[model samples]
Every structure is written in structure tokens, then in C-alpha cells.
Target: MSTTEEPTQGTTISVTEQAAEEAIALLEGESMDTDIAGLRLYVQQGGCAGLSYGMRFDNEPEEDDTIFEHHGLRVFVDPASMNYIEGSVLDYEGGLQGEGFHVENPNVVSECGCGESFRT
Candidate 1:
């Protein structure tokens, strides 16, 4: 990572060290080409709470995507999705609570019971 106090200007999302580590592990474990692969995070219009988060490994960025690098991990977010996830902190939690990437989004006003979606 750059080790800067703040994310670069225009950066809409932030990834924690743990999240970056986990993401890197997952990407590497998949046996994909890491050089051109990145984690894509976005929002969709369907879910119990009206909006759901979608994430996957992308080999290329869309024309309107914004990319951020944290601890050598690349995170891709689309312009529209950026509005709902600005200042969000991405973390990976394991053990009894659960295991996976969790988004701590400040813009969120409500979330579904299952935590799969949120309303901002």
C-alpha cells in the first residue's frame, strides 16, 4: 500500500489490511492470472433491502470504474456504486461471528435481517 494517511483523492472505498490479505489469498488460491485480476465490488438493485452487494474477480475494469490499491490488492468500484459505499471500510471477519468480507458503510441507513443488503 502507499501508507498514506488518506486514500488517494477520488477514492470512494477503503480496504483493511485483513481484507486485503484475505482477498489476495482468495485470488491467488483461485489460480487465476493475478497480474490482470482485481476484486470488483458493486451494488445491484435487488435484495431483501432493495439493494444488494456484488463482488467477484474481474480480469478487466469497465470503462467507468474507479480502481484503488491497498496493500497490493486492487479493488474496483463503479461510479454508481461509489455513491452508496463512499467512506466504507471493508473488513474480513472469521470465527464464530462469520467469515467473509463485511462492509461497514457509513451511508447505509438500514440493512436486511440477513445482512445481505442495505438501504442508503
Candidate 2:
């Protein structure tokens, strides 16, 4: 992870160290090449708030996707999704009461009661 005072230009999102570690392990388990494979983050219309965060392992990013590397984990986001999730942070919280992977999106103005959706 580059930890300079300035963030990488055009970096719209980042992943926490813990989340990156977990994601790497999962990618390895899937036998996917971490160098090219990445987790795709996007927004979809659904849930009570009209927008929901979606994530899935992608073999590679699309030509129009914006890619960022944080803590050695690659995250791919499309142009449309970038408008809604800029400056967001992806994190993982696990314990007895776990809240798996979640996005802390600064663009969100409100979230649904279920916490699965948000309105920007």
C-alpha cells in the first residue's frame, strides 16, 4: 500500500488492510490469479433505499472499469458506480456478531433500516 500524504490520483475507493487480507485468501481459495483477478464493486437498484452495494470476484476488469489497488487488493469499479461510491472504503468486521464486508460510502445521505441499501 502506498502511504504517501497524497492519495493516488483517480482513486475513487480503497480497501482496508483487514479486508484486503481476507479477500486475498478468498481469491486464493478460488484458485484465481490474484494479479489479474479482482473484486468488482458496483451499485444496483434494489432494497428499500433504491440502491444497494454489490460485489463479486471478476476474472479481470472491463475495458471501461477504473481499477485501484489498496493493501495489495485490486478493486474494479465501473464509471457509473464511481459517481455513487467515490471516496468509499471497503472493510471487514468479523467476530461472534459479524458484519462481513461492507462499504463505508461518503456519498450516502441515508441508509435503509436493514443497512443493505443507501440513498446518495
Candidate 3:
């Protein structure tokens, strides 16, 4: 978020080392410039639990977005989504069964059985 030396813990959201590595690789694979390109994390109204997680790669953060720099990766979160997942952590799980990014949200009170959605 700053032009100066990047802050370690100043980021509002956090991403795990494994998750950051995987996301960064994905970003680079997209051929997007890593300097400005970042992953956007947001929440939307849907799914069995009332809210669903959404993510995508963006060329650059919006004017109102809160940029989080962590583990050599950049994450963008809008104000609305931040309200639902302020203290959430992004993590990646990889194995034979399945592999993907997971949101470890402390604000979540209940989650759908399939784990595709959750209620704060």
C-alpha cells in the first residue's frame, strides 16, 4: 500500500506462505505484471450459507480497495467484502485428493456442509 518499505504486519488481511506461493504462481502464469497485478478476494450473497467467497486476478487495485502485501504477494479487498472477512486468512491445501485456496475466517459462525459457503 505504500511506496516506501513494505510493512510486515500492517496488512489487514493475511495469507499463508503456501497460499501466497500458489497464488503468485497463478498470477505469473496469467502473464500479468506482478508489480501491478494482484488477486482480489471478495464476498458475495449466494450459496447455501448466505454468503460465498469469490476471487479473481486483477490488473491493478481499485481506487477504494485496501491492498494487502504479504509473503511477496498482493491481495486486494474491497470495503464491502472487508466487512465480512476482515481478519480472514488465506491458505492453500494441496494433495492427491484436491487442491485449492481456503479462507480461514474467524468471524464465521456456521458453514455449509460442502464448505462452499458460510455465515458470519
lDDT of 2 by residue, 1-120 (tens): 322233457556889999999999999999999988989999999999999999999998888787888887888888788889989999999989775998999989999998999999
| Alpha-carbon local distance difference test for all models | 0.82, 0.87, 0.87
TM-score of each: 0.86, 0.90, 0.90
Q: For model 1, how big is the CA root-mean-square deviation?
A: 3.9
List runs of model 3 lying over 4 Å from the truth. 1-11
- Candidate 1 lDDT over 21-80, as tens digits, reads 999889999885666678999989988899988899988677767777788788888878
Please give the lDDT score at residue 10 for candidate 1: 54
Task: Encode model 3's per-residue lDDT on 11-113: one tens digit a residue.
Answer: 4688999999999999999998878899999999999999999999999988878888888888988879988988889999989969999999989999999
lDDT of candidate 2 at residue 81, scale 0 to 100: 87
lDDT of 2 at 110: 97
Worst 10 residues of 2 by lDDT: 1-10
lDDT, residue 80, candidate 2: 88
- lDDT score of residue 31 within candidate 2: 97
- TM-score (C-alpha, index-matched) for candidate 3: 0.90
